[model samples]
Target: MTTVEPPSWQSLRAAEARLINTGVPGVSVGNAVFESIVTGLRESLLRLAAPQQAQALGVPPVVSRGLLERVGYIDGFPNLVGTVYSFTGSGADWNRLQEARAATDAAWYQEQQISEVALLPATCHHIYPLFEGVDLPGPAVLTAEAHCYRHEGTHELGRLRSFRMREFVRIAAPDDCIRWRDDWMEQQRAWLTSLGLETSVEPASDPFFGSAARLMKATQREQELKFELRVPVGDGLVQAVASCNYHKEHFGEPFGIRVAGEPAHSACAAFGLERIVLALIAAHGDIPADWPQHVRSVLSLDDAGVA
Candidate 1:
C-alpha cells in the first residue's frame, strides 16, 4: 500500500488559522469568509445565467416552520431543524433562555411556543416554492444566495452550523430542465478548468430523507445521479468544489413549478462557495500570483468593471 502523507504544513497552517477565525458558533471569521465567497459566487453564477431568464432573488434568511412542515421536512428529518421557541414568561423566561444550555432540558422548552418558526435548512428551499400556481410564458432561471442553518452534530473547521450557499436554479418543461442540468455542468467544468483546478464528473444522488435514503443510494445509486466536481485539498480531504444536480420532478411536483401549461421539471447546480474558496486557498496557498492569470484578473475586478 502507498503510504499517505499528512496535509502540507503551509496548507494546514492556513486552514487552522482560517478555520479558527471563522468557526465561532454565531460569529467569527466564518461570517466574513462566507460573505466573501457569496459575493464572488453570485457574480460567477449570474454570468452563466440566461440573459432574459428570471432575475436573481434573495430568499429569506429563515424559512417558516409551516412551510418546511408542508414540505414534509419535519417528518423526514426533525433532527436537522433549528426550531425557534420561547420561554414562558417575561423576565424569568428570558433569564432561563440566557443561561448556558444543559443536556437534560428537552420537554421544558416545548411548553413555550411564543412563535413557531424554524431556521432555513437549505438556501434553495425558499426560492423553489415561489413558482407555486403561477403560469409563465416560458422557462425561468433564478440565482440566489442565502445563509442557511442546520442543526447537526458536526463541529468541523470548514463546515458551519450556519453557512452561505449559492445556487443557480432552473424551472421549466422537462426538456429544458434536462438541458439546463446537463449544460450547466459543462459550463461549470469549463469555468473550473479556467481556474486551474482538475475536476471529474461523477453521478450522485440526493441524501433522501428517512430510511429510504440508504435504499435509494444502494438501489438507484442515487448519490451517483448528481455529478460533483471535486479537487484534492492535500491530506485526504477532497472538497466538493461544485455540483450540478438534476432534481427532475421531485421538487417541481410539491412546489407546482409548472411549465407553460404542463407540470414543470426543475433542476439546480449548487456551488459550495466556501468549500471552493477553501480548496483554492489550500491548493494554491494565499498568493494571487499563484492562481491562473485569467482567474486572478477576474478576482481582481469589481462587478462594475474588469480590473
Candidate 2:
C-alpha cells in the first residue's frame, strides 16, 4: 500500500467549529468548513462524473415558480417552504416606505404586487430545465454549484435554511443512468475507505410527501430513488454525505429531456458539501494535516507536495 499523510483531525474540527453558527437560522463559519470539504469531494467526484472533456455550468440563484411548479414541487410539497419577496407599499411615498420598512421589516407586505422570483429550494431543479429542448446523442453530464434557500420553521446547528448543494447530474438512457449511479457508489466507497472512516451505503427511501408517500417508500424498497452514504457524526448523529438518485422516467417526461428519440432516464448524486465536512470533522476530529496519510494521499494533499 502507498503511504499517505493523515489529515489534522483536531485542526479540521477547530476550523469546522469556527464555521458553525451559534445563533438563529442563518449562515456560519461551520458552513464554510463544510464547503471546503465539499470542494475537495467534488474535485474527486468530477474525475468520475465527466472523465472526458466535459464542461461544468452554473445556473441562477433565483428560479421561477412556474419552473418549480412544472417539477411537481407545489403539488408534492404544498407546505414546501422557500423564500418569496414582494414589493413594499411605498407607492412613490419615500417617507411611508422608509417608515413601514423600518417598523418591523418582517414578511408583511402589500398585495397586488409582483413577487420577485422564488429562491431555488433545491439545486438540481434548475439543471433539468436548462436543456428542455435539446437533443443529445449520448448522456450529458453536468455539475452545478448552487445556493439553495427554504423558508424553514426550525433550524439546527449544522442544518441551515439556506445552504449550498453540489450536484452531479447525468442525463442519459436508462442503462447509462443506472450504470453511472452504480459506478459512483463504488467510487465513493473507495474514497471514504481511503479516508480511514467507517461508512454505510444503504438503499434510502424518497423524501416523499404525506403519509402515503412513506408507505410507498417502504413497499418499493425505494433504493433507486436514493442511496445514502452515511458516516457517524458521533453521539448518535449519522450524517448523509452523499445521495444517489435514479429518477427513472420521472423527470424526462416533465422536462422533455430525451435520449435519442425516447424519453431519457436521469440520475444524479448530490453531495451536501457542508454535511460531508461535518462528517469528516465528527469522524476524524478536524485538521486536514492530521488526517491519515493514506486518506491524505487520495485527496492528493500530501504534506511533502501541494494540495
Candidate 3:
C-alpha cells in the first residue's frame, strides 16, 4: 500500500458546491459530479469482483431483529444499530399520540413500539441468514450493495450516519477466506492508486461500545482481523474509505453455513462510496476540470459532461 502526506485535507463543507447537503443532519444527496464518480467506482469494484465469480445480489436495507440478535450485532453495536419502531397500539393510544404530537418528543416516542426489524448496519449481515443450514461445497463469492444505517451520532465528513456500502463477500475455509481478504487488500491499493488517491492499509477495528468491548477492539487489531484503506478526508482527519475483514467461523457457526462438512469461515472487502468521493475532492479539487487527467479519465467525468 502506498502512503504519502496528502497536500490538503479539507473539511466536509469545503466541497459544498459539489455535494448538496440535505436538511437532515448527517445526510447529503450527491449531484451529477458525485454520481459520476460513484458510478465509476462501482463499475471498477464490479470488474475486480468478476474474476472471483461473485454472484450479483440485492438485499433489503432493513434486517430482522432476530437475525441481528443471532449474529451478535445487537451485542457489539447496540449504540449504533437503528432499531425500527412503529405505532402498534389501540385507538386510545392513537389519540394519545395525536395529542402528544403537539407536546414533547418523549411523549410521542412512547407511543411507538420496537418492531421485529431494524435498519441494517452492514450488507453482509443480511446475506448469511439466507444460506443458513446450507452446505457450500463451492465456497460462495457474492457481491452486493445496500443502504446501511449506523447512528454514529455525528455529521462529520466521511462519517455519515446513513451510507451506502458495497461489499464482495467470500465464505470458505479459514485459510482460503483469509487469503481472499489479503489479496483484495493489495488489489484495492492498486485500484485506488489508479484513481490518483493515496491510501494506506492499516490495522483497524470496529467501534465496539462499552468498557468490556475495548478488549474485543484491541484483540481485533492485535489479530489483524480488520484492515482499513485510510484516506485523507479532512484537516488532520483520515477516514476508512474501504476495509477488508476476516470473520473466522463467526457467521458460519450461527448460520450453519458448512463448507466440506465443517463450519465455513468468511471474509469481505467493503467500499464506502461517499467517503471515497470525499477523499477525491480533498485530494484534488471538487471541480472535474481541476482533477488529475488520469483521475478524470478513470471516473469518466467528462463523458458525463461534468466539466
Ranking by TM-score: 3, 2, 1
Off by over 4 Å in 2: 1-17, 30-36, 48-53, 88-94, 97-116, 150-157, 219-223, 302-307
Error (Å) of candidate 1 at residue 183 is: 0.3
Q: Residue 271 deviation, candidate 2, in Å?
A: 0.8
lDDT of 3 by residue, 1-307 (tens): 0111233133222323255556666566666556777887888788767788898888889989888888888888899988999989889978877777777565666767799999999989888887999998768999889989888877666768777899999999999999999999999888888887888989999988887698999999998999999889765578999999999988989988999888889999999988888888788867657888898777666776665
Rate residue 283 of model 1 by lDDT.
Answer: 57
Residue pairs with backbone atoms closer than 3 Å in model 3 (clashes): none
Q: Going through the candidates in order, what is the number of backbone clashes in each?
A: 10, 27, 0
Residue lDDT tens for model 2, 108-127: 35443656477887778888
Q: Pick the candidate with the highest TM-score.
A: 3
Where does model 3 exceed 4 Å of error?
1-17, 90-93, 96-106
Full-model lDDT, candidate 2: 0.67
Instruction: Tell me the TM-score of model 2.
Output: 0.80
Lowest summed lDDT over 10 consecutive residues: which window, candidate 1?
1-10
